[model samples]
Target: MPKSLVNYRVRHAFLVSYLLIVCTAAVLGASQLQTDPGSITVRFIIFGVIALILMVVGAIMGAVSKKRSASDIGEWNYRKSLLSIREYEKVLGRHEEDFKVFYDDTSSAGGCCCTISAAYLLYLALGIIPEGGIDASFWFTPAATLFIIIGYALLGLTSYGIGQHSVTFGVGDFFVAPDYRGLKHAKMLEDEEALYVKSLVKIGTQDDLQALFETEWRVYLDGQPDTVYIQLKVDKAHIYDYPYLVGIIVNGPDVVERTENLDIDTRFPGIVEYMSDEGVSVLVSRFDIPSDSAELEHEPNITAQEFRKLAKALARRLIKLSTE
Candidate 1:
């Protein structure tokens, strides 16, 4: 079958299963109600309606929840919006603002409570509110309703928080900025926009890379915070010549270098190939290192292994400098 057909079938199956379970629970609750002499018809009707509404809403929310992207700016905006709503609620109570606090609170809670409440109510409607007694069933209804309300309220607040964090522009946001340094020179050659790649490079003679490694040991150290640094070099040869010298520098001074027996030349070819496959453009010479301060301004995405090696190198350098 086609991929789309498979996906449709999967979704259809899920929907059918969900509906079956819900209908079964409803039937069971109704049966229990029929047997119970003291059951109020009006109460069951009200609970059933509420439960149905919660389930529909919760399911819809759940389906859409994956589309929500969490970002720093979005989170900040949501918090601000929620706080504004809360402040308005405090000032006006139920009637103070055009936006209702109950609605706000409900949306903030998210879909979990709505789902749970609906399921609980469906069970109650089926009269399976658990035969432990009235006390057990009585608490269940209110608890389920409360959970639904709280869940939706959280969801609304979180959604709003995320919205607030998105990048906003008024007047000064520019698509292109002038490069005071030679950073933009690399991009100009390829007729492409500027893209940055960051990795640390060890400075010294060929033997310095090996010396740096011997000074640093590979061990999990505590009470030390992990730090990531992005280094830019104008020279590509510096990268090729050092082998895993950059990795050694980042690992820290105490890390032992095992370059003698290992082939660093071939191992990094895979990384280069991977980057090339990923469409990453490179434009740097052999060995010239860029200024640290200038490189620090631009954040570049680095691979996990690259980051670890760079971090270890920095730690080693820090240790050596401190001792000196």
Candidate 2:
């Protein structure tokens, strides 16, 4: 049989055993009450209620196990193994805080489940003792209680094992933050707010390159706090009317001399209005070249050498901005 089916069967069997034991105990207790006219009716009532509770709990747990199994199978069928690591990293990055919460919650749940299940198993075992036989027997009650506690501890560990595997396979918990701090930090030149420039070489189609740019920008933007100002200086690269390389300079709120795009000069007012509506102090300018040719000479294509230079410049700028 398949692994999922096997797991389902095992869980079902455990629950069935638990329910059967409780039901059998209830039946035996009820029988004893009928025979002995002096028997305590309260004892029978208490046992019956306890048994019913266990049966219900077991049934609910069984349902949850089955549902989890089905989800695992579906994910197994749909998921690709090659990208598993990348996906895991992506999840960690995007939902760092959420993952922490999930880990803590599941661990606590596992511990409680183990402890409670053990206690119930002990209760069932102790029920086997005749009421009048040995009222003060220390051996059976203590031993049974110990065994139940240990058994549930082991069961909880098993549950955790199942959860870990399920999460790894993209089956169990999928909780994570929508925007991860890692991506933001990756693009960051320094810890403080300041201006930074980064350039991307685009050898592919404009659409493909643009997609990459958007992905990077979105991740960075999402990581920032709402109070920060973000500005983007865009340098468009064109090859036969098709845009290629795009250089970007990101500046924070303190930057002076507002940059303008010649191509869409008229659109700036609308863009500013949109940003205001969205509660973001950010703007993306079109490719702009000044009449003075000295600026072009200074801001040349960003090579590996240029990147190092920019990193240092960004660091210095951040220091100045923070101190100010």
Candidate 3:
């Protein structure tokens, strides 16, 4: 719940409590002359207890408000974005200002309420809160001890759930930014934008490549009208097993004349060679990596040293595949 709403509800409770106490006091004083002293004492004790309970509840609400300070929420959202791709800006080409993200995972209903109930049971078994001790809380402080235990447990659960699944942006997710295409097609793709503003989220800094060319390279790649290029970037994600950028080329300069799954190198991965428009041949993965290096980025188009000469290597392949 929002902090504002919580505070509003607490304030309303306090206001109602005060009104009820005032009205009860006036009615009791008016009837004092007709009632016995014993009954009057009982009524006084009851109203006093009610006011005390309301005060304690108010104090709890105040502490909760402080714990969820505005700064805490802002910091939490920033840190949470890094774990997953939910914050699309790091991957998609969208105007940073226009994007908005949302998160929703409610705790199981009565989650902490149940915990408190269990604590009551345990206290009864150990004789801390007597067997008929439910109302004994008014006379003792053990009830507050149980409340403290439940509160900490609830906070821990909330933190744990947030940590486990940091993001939900999946494989095909994308954002449309004019800057992505140098603002040329921003107007063209405007109608294709999401209904709501995207949220900015935390993205990992472990590899600069992901930030440079996100998994949505497909969006950038497919957007080009005539250019086919070479891409040597890490797997489309931060959580993936592979840690290195793998070289892959698009729009071969030559159509593949034929294709055969061949082991080009015993130590290196294999290839599926095939050909199309403008001498375009789709040359991609064919061999499975050995288990030991299974996590290595699969670069079927180019070898180690050749990767450093990426542009020239791609041009050469485009030529060889085209004219041959």
Leading candidate by lDDT: 2
Candidate 2 residue pairs in backbone clash: 95-176, 95-177, 118-148
- RMSD to the native, candidate 1? 21.4
1-324: candidate 1 lDDT, tens digit per residue: 112112344444544554554454445444443454345553354345534443554355334331232111111111111112223323233222321211222243446445455545544444324355344355345454443344333333333333222222111221112121222222222221121222111211121111000011122222332221222222223222121222112332332322222212221222211011122221111111233435543333233344334334433443342233
Instruction: In model 3, state the lDDT of residue 153.
Output: 36
TM-score of each: 0.23, 0.26, 0.31
| Candidate 3 weakest ten by summed lDDT | 69-78
The lDDT values for all models are 0.31, 0.34, 0.33
The list of candidate 3 runs beyond 4 A from truth reads 1-100, 103-139, 142-228, 231-267, 270-272, 277-279, 285-287, 290-315
By the TM-score metric, which is better: model 1 or model 3? 3
How should the candidates be ordered by lDDT, best one leading? 2, 3, 1
What count of clashes does model 1 give? 60
What value of lDDT does candidate 2 attain over all alpha carbons?
A: 0.34
